[model samples]
Structures are given as C-alpha cells and as structure tokens.
Target: MDTRQRLRTSALVCAAAVGMLISGCSSGSSFSEASAPSGSSVASPPGAVSTEELKTYYAQRLSWRDCGVPGFQCATLRAPLDYAKPDGRSVDLAVARVKATGPGKRIGSLLVNPGGPGGSAVSYLQGYAGVGYPAPVRARYDMVAIDPRGVARSEPVECLDDKDMDSYTQTDQTPDDKPEVAKLSTAFKGFAAGCKSRSATVLPHVSTVDAARDMDILRGVLGDEKLSYVGASYGTFLGATYAELYPDRVGRLVLDGAMDPSLPARQVNRDQTAGFETAFKSFADDCVQRALCPLGTTSPEDAATRLKDFFAKTDAQPIPTGESRPLTESLATTGVIAAMYDAGAWPQLREALTQAMAGDGSGLLALSDSYYEREPDGTYTNLMYANAAVNCLDAPPAFTTPNEVDAAVADFEKASPVFGRGFAWASLNCAYWPAPATGSPHRIEAKGAAPILVVGTTRDPATPYKWAQSLADQLSSGTLLTYEGDGHTAYGRGSDCVDTAINTYLLEGTPPRANKRCT
Candidate 1:
C-alpha cells in the first residue's frame, strides 16, 4: 500500500480489467490446495543450466484437467526452485489455458500477463484475458497464463496476516516528525520481517529474471518454439527480460505500459510520481468542468490545493468511515492513487472525493480497500506481499534511510505536489527488506530478437509513456506504438487502432510501423 511501491505495482491491471470482465466478483482464486510445498532452499549459482540438466523439465508433459471454469483447463508445471541446480528442489507453477476456438488455422499458444509482479496471472486469464481479449486473436491462439513463483497460488510469499496487514496499510507513510518517522520505519521493518519469517524458502528466488526463466520453461512445456506473449505493466519488464536472455526464443510480444529496466529504483519512483501528477491534472481539468467539483471549480491548480488541504486535514483528524477503521491520510492517498491508474475510475473518484469532502470517508476508504485487494471479510489477497517480494528482489531499494527520503522530498514534491511526499517515504520500505537485491538497473537490448511491439499510453499514471519510449528504444527490435490517451495500458481499453495493430502483429508477425500513433 506504500505509494513508493506504486511506482511499478501501479501496472496492476486486475482492478479495472477484472471489473470490465466480470461484475461484483473477486478476480482472484484460492489455489492453496494446489500450492507447492514450502520450506526447501538451496544455493544454486547463477548461470546457464546445461541442456542435459534441463531435459527433465523440458520433456515433462502437463496433465491438464477441467479448471472448474467452463472452457478453461488447468495444470501445474514443475520448474527448478533454483535453476542452476535443475535436479534440486522444484516449484510447481499454476497454469491455465483456454484452447483456441479456431476457424482459422491455430497459430500457437499466446501467453498473457497483466502487470502485477504479484498479480495472479491464472485469475487474470480466467477473469479477463482468456474471456475478454479480442475475438480474432483468441480464436487463433490458445490463451494462456502462469502464476509466477511467490505470486498467487504459486508458493506465495506471506507477509503480515490480515489484521496486521490492515494496520500496516493504515500506517502513516508521510511522517510529520521524528517519532512518526521512526514508527513508519518500524512498520516497514515489521512487514519485511514477517515475510522473511513466513516465506523464507521462496524469498530469494522470486526475482524477475527467475520469473522470466520460468516463462521460458512454460513456453517449452506448451510445445511452442518461441514465446508469443502480451505483457502489460510490470509484465513488460518480464517480457523484455525474457527477450534479453533468450533473444532467439522471442516470438510475437506486445509490451503495453512498458517499464524501463535501466532506471534506478529512486528514478523509477520519481518518474512515476510525475506520471501520476500528469494523470491527476487530467482528472482535475475534467473535474472542474463538472457541476459537483469538490476540489474546486476555479482551476486545476485550485483543485490540487484543495486536495492537498483535504489530505492535510485528514492527517490532522482522520475521517471516520461507517466501519471500525477510520480513513487516515495514508488510506485516502492510496484511494486517490488507485483511481489514477485508469481514467474510467475518475467519476468514481469524483464521487468519493465529494463524499469525503462531505465528511463520509467510506467511499474513499472503499477505493483504498480495492487497491489493497482487501476482501469484505478483511482477509487479503497475496498481491501486495508478492509485489514487495518481486520488486525488492528485482532492484535495489530507492532509499537506504529516512535521511535520504527527507533529502529527496523536495525533488519528489517538485515532481508531484500532491502525492510526492508520501511516495518518497513509501520508497523507504524496501530498504528494510529481508533479502538482498539480486538484480540491479540495467538496459535490456534484446539483440537479434524478433520485432517486439511496445505500447505506451500518453497519460499512463503508473508506467509512464516516457518509460515505454525508453523501453522501446532500449530493445534492439522494439517498435513503439503510441496511444495518445489516458490509462495504464493501451490495447483492449477500447482503442480499435491499438487493438488492430496488436492483433495484426500477433497474427501476421508484422509489427506496426515504428512510432505509430493512435488516438
């Protein structure tokens, strides 16, 4: 729930994508009974696994069964817990697929990942991608998804329990003074410690590189010579990593809402702050024209001031919701940040802001709950925990201490006057992470890879358009497809141009022209 983590976690496509696919239903499934055994760890040195070592994994065939959801088949695939030692402890990855409903000759399996480093790919496949992707695309390609290690249903990393998590989510992220800062630091330490205590076995191995390797294993298991994928948000990073490691294995890939792998963690967080600021201004401009503008009717600047003032007021005196927990400044900020991911949520945000301004914090609090994936019964999905795990492992922390955060506050605030301070402090959490970072900022030039499509939305709040541009430039064969619009991702958000370009690329293996723009 920390805003700093929102830098990459913002690519979480579940909330909006699932909402569009299914009404009034949870997008996640509890695959606990099918989860792999935990508590096994081994030191596997980093390097290529010899083909001999990987033969067992590659030769294994999936035993698919009815997934209990009509038209879907579920199965589990075994991968090395540590790839360096393929014969060592193994992990089971949950995979789901809806075979191609073909009128045209079947092309191949199309793997889709909807951006949460922690997002449940299985659930996404069931709730959205498998059912909601464009018909022509789905008809020729067997839609597929795999829950990566330490994500939902795949030996998930457990941090704080439900009650502790609720308290953690409510923890004040933007400290006003020394004691508050110390308290915030303690909360972060506690969350990290909880993860270490609960998920020691899988902590070190859930890095993005590891997940990308798992994707390759999946590709082989699916009998596909190359990977045909559509990765959004953090999934873009995942796909790019796969291409970087195995350039020849790259097939049709559409990396929507692309993330730049070359930027350091702090820069990523700061850039995202600016991205959210851009999105908020868009919202503000739209809001002030409405009859019930809670922020202000004067100008976007006035609206921002009012929103900041409202945040300050809530910080001073938390607003009470109908429930036992009141809406704190942290929760309110999360609520607003959640809405920024998709413009579709703007009206909901307007209503929530209006209700909060009228002293009812329930609406905003509900938005916060949705962002955290907290269920009505107060239990939570493993999304946030896995988000922290994967992200913390993928790159070094944004800040090593409170002093660094304090020093960077001015820069962050300059980037985003409203959400900057909170986001800067939120970046401090990963500094207390239990495992050392296994990866670092590095460019991914997938030299000799097949042409990969990179899609960017003009006002994408989470993964900014600039990141997409940077990613496209970095990948040797990457083609940029620009959507001059708002939202976290471009394709399937009702843009015929974007969809047509991607579908054509998927079917015909021809990427759109470089820098193709669509409104």
Candidate 2:
C-alpha cells in the first residue's frame, strides 16, 4: 500500500458524498456527566490534559438548534485550536445528533465516525448512521457526530480553487523525469501554500491527536460516562488515539476497518497499495466471469497488464469523453482507484474500463469526479485539503523529496506494480507543508482501556486486514473481529455474522470472543 491509496481511503464521514465508498451530532448548551476523563493517563502519555484544567470547557453549554432535518439537531462548540495553549484561540466544531428512537432503557450516546480524518461526521449522522444503524442500537442510544475541527462544517481547511484543483488532480503523479518531477513538486507546494494561506488559523491544529482531544470534549459535553464509538477507516486512528489519551473513558469502541497507529505514513501508504492490488485482483477475477469484462481475460496479472497499457495509451493520447476534458492516464487511474474501494462498485468499474477501452471516457470520468468530490459545475469541497492537512500534521511526510520517492519506488512496486509509483509520488504532497507536525509515529497501546473491538475485512482495499490485527494486538484489551470477505469495512455490509457480533457489542457491551473470525 503506497500513499496514493491512503488518500483514496478517506471516506466523507459514514455517508458516501459521491455514493462511491463508505465511511455525525448533538449539542445542548449544557448537560451533566457525573465525571469527566480523569487526570490518569495510562502509559504515562504526556499529551493527556488533566480533568481539572478542562472543567470549564466540559461544563460549557451548547446552544442546539433544529437544523434543516427533522429529528436532527445541530450546534456549535469551541475547542482550543492548540491544546498546548488552552487559554489561546479556539475553533468552532459542528455537531449533530438524532435522539434514541426506541422505548428501551437508553444506553447513553453512540458516537460514529466514517473513516476520513476529514470526513463530516454531521453529514454522516444526518444522512446515514443516524437513521440507517440497527434499530435496537438506535433505540437505546442517541447517535452523535461531530465535524472534527478543520473538517466540513467545522473550521475547514481550504486549498486550491475548483479550476485549480481540476488541473492539480490531473497532474501526472507518475512523473518520469526531472521536469515532470518539478511539475509535481510545484503542484504540491501550491496545494500546501493554498491551505496555509487560506486556513492558517485552522490547518496547524487539525491533527488526529487534536481531534481525539475534541472527541473527549464531545464525550464530556454529551454527558456520557464513557465514549462509545463506531469509527471506520481513518476514523479508527482517531478512536485509537482517544483510547490512548483517555483509556479510562473508553466504552464499547468498535474500530471498523481499523488503522494501525504504530505504522508511519509511508508504511501505511505502502500497505494500502498492496491492499488495492488485492482488491483489483478480486475485481479482475469477478470481471472475467462477466460478459462485459474490459480486460477480456481471466488472468489477473494479464488484466493488470492490459490496464497498464490503457493508462499508457491515455497518457500519450487522452481519450475523448462527452465533456471537454479528455480522459488522461491520471484520471483513469483515479477512476479505477475509486471503484476498488467496494466490491459492489466492480460492475461500474468494468463498464467504465470497457467504455474507456472503446475511447469513450465518460464513465471513467464520472468515477474520478466522484472520488474527488468534484461537481459538474467545477466547484470542489475541502475534503482533499483537510485530508492533507490532518494527514500531514498527524505524521511527517513519507518522502521529503522526489529523489527519496525515486529511491522508494522499487519497494512500492514490489508491493503493487499497478499503484506503487503513482502512490509514492502522491505522498510528496505533505513534504512542503507549512506547519511542523505536532504528532510523531508511535503506538497507541491504550494500556488501561476496557475491551476495544477492532474489525477487519479480508480484502479491504483502503485499510488492509493486517492493520486491524496489528491494532488489536497492540491495545491493552483490544479484541480482533475478522470479517472474511471483501470491501473497505466489515460491519453493516450484509454479513450476518459480522453484524451480529458488532450489534451484540454495541448493544449489550459484551464483546465477541477474542480473535473471532466471521465469514
């Protein structure tokens, strides 16, 4: 898994903004939680803020209002932009929630995050999890989401404008020479500059650790005894960090499509590249069984080879789509990456590939558009900007220079021939970030936390299953739940065994047997 795959892995909350891949809130001006996170920081974590210091913040009341949606409430709360200076500036966090629906004993609040560190938890809660989650769980607990600082509805990080981003995303990531490398470098520099200039106040404060602290704030404000969470994809990282910081406050954590906090940015990206290859192979195998198979062969290697040939062809002479923009190799690869997220989207990928192979690039273009959250009008959201902001701040760049990336290509190629070079170069986006990272590469053992459930899918493209295993192994009381199937995450994707186990945990607080494997 190289870095490009990691970027594609950030979901827009639990709801699919473009309906492509998977992955919010409440406020009261005031509520009474009997106790807040203690000063006790297990493992002697230096980052944890003592309960005494945060009392004023925890006691602050939120002024909730009826948002556009019925049964959904929205509000804003202020979190210190930087935890180091608690008396310093603050950033507004957007929150939303749907109250429990059933007449059962309420089980407190159930907070959900849909993977991307930048994903909008408010939109997710309002659109999907708030209503789509299991009835029993919904009945028992209020579904909550918070647009973590520097995310949508929060103080979002803004980079390039739409037209500029259109040009930026199409920049050739697999640069072959010095001139091309400089072009890619310029794009990255411009993107980092854009964020720093437009969102300087917020960009430096959006690290996962900052977000984890915000989650504790949410737990305190929600008046919950502990934090019960369902975090997917990159959200798993946030949840784990929270556990690491507030081990005593952990309650029924389900880290679906879990990420290993121990792995640095480069290793994570490389692993994700391999995961994409695994998923691509699965898609290819499935494609061969269909009549519209674009690769037109049963061999997965041959399929990859043929697809590479298509990318080369597009690189030289981009195919014409219905729109003015031609389908370049970069765009085509983005389209393919988008589909590799979910097995359900394989048919769409095949059709897109088939259409592209026939010189009509509309289908592929749409997929690429969806992945980037690009609208037809050429406007764009801040997903990519916040993604880079949080990611770069959470960990240092995988490569600091094009030469370093060149040196890493061989290992990445060994990981995934299809995505290695592109992803490796893609990692350079953070090298030029203006803010020095606040966090470092370290393991979150959560040494005193109660049972934390880490879920994994066998062939998940974005977050590989091994990450879940690693996370479960590292945590003080983490339980590994294996979903032996495909797609990004395991729960709520039609696996009866996986759903039942998670539902049981989320509902009853009784975790499945350790290392439980569900097919």
| Per-model TM-score versus the true fold | 0.92, 0.94
Find the candidate with the highest TM-score and give its number: 2
lDDT at residue 38 of model 1 (Cα atoms): 14
Candidate 1, residues 1-519: lDDT per residue as tens digits?
A: 433233223344521111000000111222221121111211122665654567677666788889899999899988899877777899999989998987898998899998777888888888778878999998899999999899888889998889999899888878999999999999989999999999999999899888988887777767676889999888899999888877878899999989899998889888888888999999999999988888879999999999999999999999989999999999999889888877777878898899998899998988888777888788898888888888888888888999999999999999999988887888887898899999989998988889999999999988889999999999999999999998789888888999999999999999999899998
Q: Where does model 2 exceed 4 Å of error?
A: 1-33, 42-49
* Per-residue lDDT of model 2, residues 1-519, tens digit only: 222222233342321111111211345425343546667553333554556666778887778889999899888877888776777787889988888987888889899988666677787788778887888889999998998888889988898877888888788878888999999899889988888889888877888888888888878887787999999888898889899888888999999988888877788788887888898888888877776688976677888889888888898888999877889888888889888777767777787788889889988888787777676677876777777777888877788988998999999888888877787788777789999877788877888888999999999888888989999999989999999988888877888899999999998889999889998
Clashing pairs in 1: none
lDDT, each prediction: 0.82, 0.79
Runs of candidate 1 with Cα error greater than 4 angstroms are 1-45
Model 1 vs truth, CA RMSD: 6.7
